[model samples]
Target: MVEIIDVDAENVDKYGFFCMRSKPNSDGYQKKLNWVKERLKEGLKIKIIQENGRQKGFIEYIPGEFTWRAINAKEYMVIHCFWIVGKGQGRGFGSQLLNGCIDEAKQLGLSGVALVTSEQGWLPNKKFFERKGFKMVDKIDEFELMALSFNENSKPQFYDWNESAKEYKEGITVFKSDQCPYIQDAVRNIIEASKDLSISVQIVDMDSYDVAQKKSPTPFGVFTVIYNGEIITYHPETKNRFIKMINKKNLLTNS
Candidate 1:
């Protein structure tokens, strides 16, 4: 059974499913746990599934401040991030988590919920949002935009994100590759951590790095935060430091 718990970031040292693979005391592993805990404080809403009283799987949802036009800003829940761990697989646990999200949204009086997912091959589509009754409302390049509007009237109205809103002063641009799940998870965590910040996230496919660099001159790294089109941080695969980078970036831009 999946039970929603009000967990503090500190308890993950023992209860965090994310750190089970490696000894938590190891320096690098401890860093990862700290990162998860920090991000959790930034709008991270978590739920865990227990099988025979052991955590078989868990999901995390980060709610952010950005408003989606789903049934107006008055009634919409934007799912900034959600994840189900590897141990939590093959038991229909994912679907249960999704249902829980729906029920939670309904309880909150949200007209609907909106999220972004890969179009099949980009990520495991089946495990993403397919069975949750989410439908493709639009597609931009390889990324697919989806929504599950509880109230039919709550459909999302989107427009071309203002690519020209304002040029970032200057920073590093870290191009993220899909091959690294840890990097992806880091990105997810930071995005969640950035819930109330005045920042923008652009998902780029590293496959087009050379082309993107030629298209625009900037430092290219993976799973990183950018400030004015410059790379602020780069890691081969680590979830920590992203939020700190993002917080710093936002300050620079908003200043």
Candidate 2:
């Protein structure tokens, strides 16, 4: 039996978000819980999919005007996360969740439902959105902005991230938000890795949607690592991975 439940601020504690379900006490989970609470007021929605009384997956989205991604999608609904894992795969649960979100967007008179997809890991892949009739409207690096528009001419596009990158031309800078449950660990590892290399690092928190839309160097928006003015990674990496990445770029000299 497949069932979908709507999670709101009032019941989010009772029905935890899909990620970190086993580690609710972790900093990442608690931070995400608080973040979700604030985003709920901005028209964010989370729906969980269950199969035979077990949680299988969840989908999270918000009105585009309030989105944390680097996009100008004021009249659209932007999906932040979508996952169907374990036994939920190949069972049409993903489509079910997407269709529900689409229906809600249509009901709200939004232009479309937008999503950021990638060929890399973390975000969903573009093929899934393509199968559901979404089209790529913009591309930056490995990330693609896709949308299924109700009005043919209306589409979402990414911001001019080049200008944003120019602002962090020196040293290692990490931009992060609480939108993802795993970013806390990633940021912590980044700090530790930089310390080991005897490098100075700056941490910028995307405390508001305005800051995120204007300054996030990539569509992922939640976590980004910039080394010497260029975006290195859009998602989190382990301490060792960070060390190797910096070394590979020759950003630091081996004394």
Candidate 3:
């Protein structure tokens, strides 16, 4: 039987939300756990799918105002992460988890459910959300802001990137947070890459939703790598890829 477990302070320690079954004792896990703990009081909801005592998938969402993204989340629930791994993919688990969020939004009398999606990296592709009746509300760069609205008058919006991106003027600047378990490793990789390339990279650790919403270089929020005032990407990659991206950018800049 498939069971959905809501992660709370009571059972958070018992289950891994993102980096499931691996790196339990790692700093990333602890950081993300602590982040989750704090957000719970602000209305973050995380639901995990389990079958035969094994975790199969999970989804995390929060009130728009408290969402890490730069959006004006006044009357909606913004999904931070949604995933169903391994054998969980082709089954009905994804729908189950998504429907759970939709149902909760209705209960809370939220205007709708919203999320930022992309064709690449951390966020999910737009297809699934579109299939579930989410419409493309806005777009910033490659990220698509999608929402499923119950109220015809409610229109969700993406945070202002034009002003936010201007916050970092030059060099390699990384705006990051502990919201995801893997971000620690991603930051480490970026640091290592910076050192190898002899580049000075500034790390801006986003400790709260306010900081992220106000300072994120990209509208998608989470983790972003900015090179010379322009956002390279919103997701982290390997050291080699980072180097290549930087080198390519340098080439274009010098050309």
Candidate 4:
């Protein structure tokens, strides 16, 4: 008896219930949810499942920028969040919600759909996606990235790294900030592993605008996986874009 419906302002509480179950009590979980709800801008797709007239579960999806690196720019779809209430499970509500997402992808004319899944241990069951024809598209350490492609011909795009120090040899150009531990670590790994490669990672102090304006500082450091001027992505869920100017080899990324 599960029925999926669109997300509305008044019934967000239902969606909140599902999200809390997915992530549980954290420092600023509630605040973050409220903020996202209030400030959601474009390309947000949401649905709620009601079983026998009772709220059972919900789902929220968006572009791949927030979830995985966007390997394909022609089109992208992402599942930002999903959950089923305690009492709603074991009653087949999960299948209904996933089906809704599939139908939604088709309706939106999307090339594919992707999501970051913590659907393991106490989170959503890992098999939840398998039942819906999704496959483990990629992985970055522990982050489980899954995707469901509607198109028959889907191949992920890869990035080529730059390895020329002719631009800045003495400035000690570090590619990351401590703010983003992943980027920081990638920088560390490259600098540390430079003994094995031709590139050296160094910390450079520059204005935020300089970082923004310059192409070398685009990959913000958190989820972006870059090394030696090449992009390393196991997750296509988030948007991983590297824009370089000609043969200069200064790479930039955002998302």
Query: What lDDT would each prediction earn against the true structure?
Result: 0.50, 0.90, 0.86, 0.47
Over 1-255, each residue of candidate 2 has an lDDT whose tens digit, in order, gives: 889989998899989888998999999999999999998999999999998879988899999999988889998999989999977799999999999999999999999999898877599887888999999998877878999999988888998886577678787999999999899999999999999998889999998998898888787788889988877887788999999998887745445
Residue 120's lDDT in candidate 4: 32
In the range 1-255, model 1's lDDT, one tens digit per residue, is 456444566555556543244454554455446545655654455566666666655555444232211111235555534456577677777677667777777787777766645533223253366666778766544445567877886565334432421354433344454322355565565555545454455555544323322222221112434556554544442334655666666687789
Predicted structure with the largest TM-score when compared to the true one: 2
Task: Score every model by TM-score.
Answer: 0.52, 0.96, 0.95, 0.50
CA RMSD of all predictions: 12.0, 1.8, 1.4, 11.5
Better structure of 1 and 4 per TM-score? 1
Lowest-lDDT window of 10 residues in candidate 4?
A: 238-247
Best by lDDT: 2
Better of 1 and 3 by TM-score: 3
lDDT leaderboard ranking: 2, 3, 1, 4
Give the Å error, residue 143, model 2: 1.6
Tens digits of per-residue lDDT for model 4, 1-255: 656777655655555434434543442345445544542554555677886777677776655443222233235466655678788877777777777777776787877776545533222344778777777765543445567787757632311113322344442254432221124334444444444434444555322222321333221211333344454431212111221111134333331
**Cα displacement (Å) at residue 91, model 1:** 2.2
> How many clashes in candidate 4?
16
Report clashes for each candidate as comma-separated counts. Answer: 9, 0, 0, 16
